[model samples]
Target: MFVDIHCHLDAVKNASEKIALAEKENVSLIVSNSVDIKSMEKNISLSKRFPIVKVALGIHPSEALSMNEKEIEKAFSFMEKNLKKAIAVGETGLDFKHAVTEKRRELQRELFKRHISLALEFNKPVIVHSRNARKECINILSEMNAEKVLLHWFLGSKKLLFEAIENDWLYSIGPSVFENPAVQKFALLSPLKNMALETDSPVLFNGKPAEPQWIPRIAKKIAKLKKTPLKKVETVTTNNAFRLLGLQQKG
Candidate 1:
């Protein structure tokens, strides 16, 4: 069974229907990730309501400006209260393109640090959202010793990619690899064991739409690009997802 390591399934109004489709296709599991506290609560509720779905909770960098110590504390408190019900801590990282002011950057960095701290404290994997801030993100994560980091939809610099590999962190490739040169390079250089695939569904792709089912399509393209067998690619990626999230691979 294929496992989508990162997807905002809970945010989709028809999430149940989409999940049912995944079940029919033998994609039995998906890690439903949330952007902020409210979304995290929704994701957790959805997971409790649906066994096939699991959750990752964190504040996204785009929404970092709104976060403060109180909010961070509340999020931590909620996470501790529902530790068993969640899987990871993220969708968090730096987004310099979106953060225009110096103050915003400071807040973003602080928020990122707090998220990393929470991840380490909870012993959960982190789904990072980095954009135009590769160097800063890498340095912060490295300093914090983020053991299980998932760099989602990474379009970062080559130097950062090497650092991630050096640190044994997992990089998740999305549909962008089909068109983005940097993503293609990552797929070409990274082996099946180090690569994970995501859809980041409900997000547009080439002016068109994307879905969780698109994960296997991304995997197929990656397999073809790497000249590996589909079965091998699927096996390694699925194994990585299960291992990183501490979930047993189920049929």
Candidate 2:
């Protein structure tokens, strides 16, 4: 069985079809992450309809930047109320690439901290998105002493990557490994036990929309990079994902 640790099922058009395709490809678990309250609710609904679908509830950093105090509070309240239905707290973290100003970056950091606290409070794993803010994100996670962290699509410096690896934080490798030298290097350097696969579904890669069914291709890339058997890569990554998400492994 394969697992996709980070995907935006709510954002995908015809998500049911996508889920079906994933199942056919042996993708047994899909952790659909949300960027807002509405997507969170939709993801919950999708989880109910699709047995393989699970949810991670949190506001995206880019989305949070535009929300007012009241809206943010409302989002927090909703997540707290429905956290039991979620497998993790995520699609959350800093993105300094878009939040260019110092003030904006600080706000994102504060929001990131809050999400981390909430996840800690609920004892849920966090699926993070730290674009161009990997160092800052790692610093905060370190200060908070957070465990059960999954850094999705991480392309940080080798030093920072090694730091995360040493801390035992998991990193999600996506389809970019096929084309991105940095991601391929990440797959090669990071131990398979500390790595998992993600497609970030419905997101374009090389002008093509990704789906959970692409997990095998990503796994193949990793196997090739590590010069290990495909079966070992599949077994290790799927187990790593299930363990990180606190789910019992299924065949």
Every model: Cα RMSD to truth: 1.8, 1.0
In model 1, which runs have C-alpha deviations exceeding 4 angstroms?
67-73
Q: Alpha carbon lDDT of residue 221, candidate 2? A: 88
Model 1, residue 177: distance off in Å is 1.9
Measured by TM-score, how close is model 1 to the native structure?
Answer: 0.92
lDDT scores of the candidates, listed in order:
0.82, 0.91
Listed in order, each prediction's TM-score against the native is 0.92, 0.97
lDDT of 2 at 214: 99
The CA lDDT at 42 in model 1 is 86
Per-residue error for 93 in candidate 1, Å, reads 0.9
Candidate number of the best TM-score: 2
| Residue 223 local lDDT, model 2 | 92
Write the residue-wise lDDT of candidate 1 on 1-251 in tens digits: 67778889866758888888777766767888887779888888888788888898888888756777798778767766775568888788999999989989988898889889888988998889888887888899998888899988876567777788788788888889888877888788876767788888768888765677777788889988999888888889888888888888654
As a whole number from 0 to 100, the lDDT of residue 71 in candidate 2 is: 89
